[model samples]
Target: MEWLAPLAETGVARALIAAPTLYLLVNAAHIMGIGVLYGSILALDLRILGLNRSVPLHVIAGFLSRMAAAGAGLAILTGLCLFSVRPVEYAGNAAFLAKLALVAVGLAHALVLHRGIGWRRATTDGHASAALRLSALASIIIWTSAIVAGRWIGFL
Candidate 1:
């Protein structure tokens, strides 16, 4: 954990930690990124769960996936910047650890869904298997948990 102290004292971290307004702005950006990411994810998952039957699955997945990716990129960049400001504290925070674990699970679920037959069926036939539906449900749960854990980090 002490190793992270050096990182927290780096130039970028020093600037961020020195400027409270800058830190707030970055935190705001991170929140916006989370909103975009979760919004796209919820929309896509809802479609898969039969909420928007009129829209084609491929259409929904195509654009939303890209948006989600962009949001994820932004979130990750800002999150890292924020982490750099207090690396040792975050590294040891229980809520941060839980959030990181949930993020991994969410990403793994997305990978499996994209690479498996569920994606194909959903795109081609506009229908998904029960397993796919379960995956969608799990996505909602996992992502929501991650968000919750992230919020909990502040209290911890």
Candidate 2:
């Protein structure tokens, strides 16, 4: 926690604090990133869970997955910049901690599922196994929880 103090003193943090509009822009960017991430993941997960049977899973999966990844990358980048503004406070905030943990778990779960044979098979043949469906369900839950926790941070 002591080491995090320097983050608040960094140039980025100073700039954010000095420029109100810059902070607003960064915050807006972060929101966009989150929107993209959640929207893409929701669509992909719903598809895997048997929504819109007319569409091929593999086709949408690739595009949505890539979109999700891009969103996540943008979110992470902007989030770090935002976090730098008050690193120590955020580090101590329970809701922030929970959000971070949930995000980590979600990412880990996605990685494991993507690396497994089930993901490969599903993406290859457009058929989701029971395990894949279950994973998709879990993903929905995890990501939703993470977003909730993120919102809770300000209240806490």
Candidate 3:
């Protein structure tokens, strides 16, 4: 935690704190990143759940996965900068802790989904199995919950 204090004093952090408009812009970017990331994930999850049967699973998953990854990368970078502004307070915030935990779970779920045979089967078979649909449902719940928890950080 002591080491994190230096992060707040860094050049970028100092500039962000000094310039309210800059912080707002970064925060806006974070929101946009979240929208892209979660929106792509939700679309893919819906496809897995049999929403758009006409589209190929791999085609949608391949493109949306890249979009989600890019969004996540941008969100992570901006989020770290934002956190550096009030590291000590954020570390102690219950909502922040919950958000972090949810984020970790969401990432783990994605890892498992991508590595599992169910994903492969769903992509190749042109139809989702019960298990794949269940996974998609779980994905939707997990990602939505994570987003809710992230928003809660501001209130709590």
Residue pairs in candidate 2 whose N, alpha carbon or C atoms collide under 3 angstroms:
none
> In model 1, which runs have C-alpha deviations exceeding 4 angstroms?
none
Q: Which candidate wins on TM-score?
A: 2
Write the number of the candidate with greater lDDT, choosing between 2 and 3.
Answer: 2
Judging by lDDT against the true structure, name the best candidate: 2
lDDT of 2: 0.95
What is the clash count of model 2? 0
User: Backbone clashes per model, in order?
Assistant: 0, 0, 0
> What is every candidate's alpha-carbon RMSD to the true fold?
1.1, 0.6, 1.4
Expressed as tens digits, the lDDT of each residue in 40-122 for candidate 2 is 99999999999998999988898999999999999999999999999999999999999999999999998999899988988
Error of 3 at 105 (Å): 0.7
Provide the lDDT at 99 for model 2. 98
TM-score of each: 0.95, 0.98, 0.93
Writing each residue's lDDT as its tens digit, candidate 1 over 1-156 gives 988898888887888989999999999999999999899999999888889688888777878877887888889899999999989999999999999999889988888888988888787777778998889899999999999999999999
**Compared to the true structure, candidate 1 yields what TM-score?**
0.95
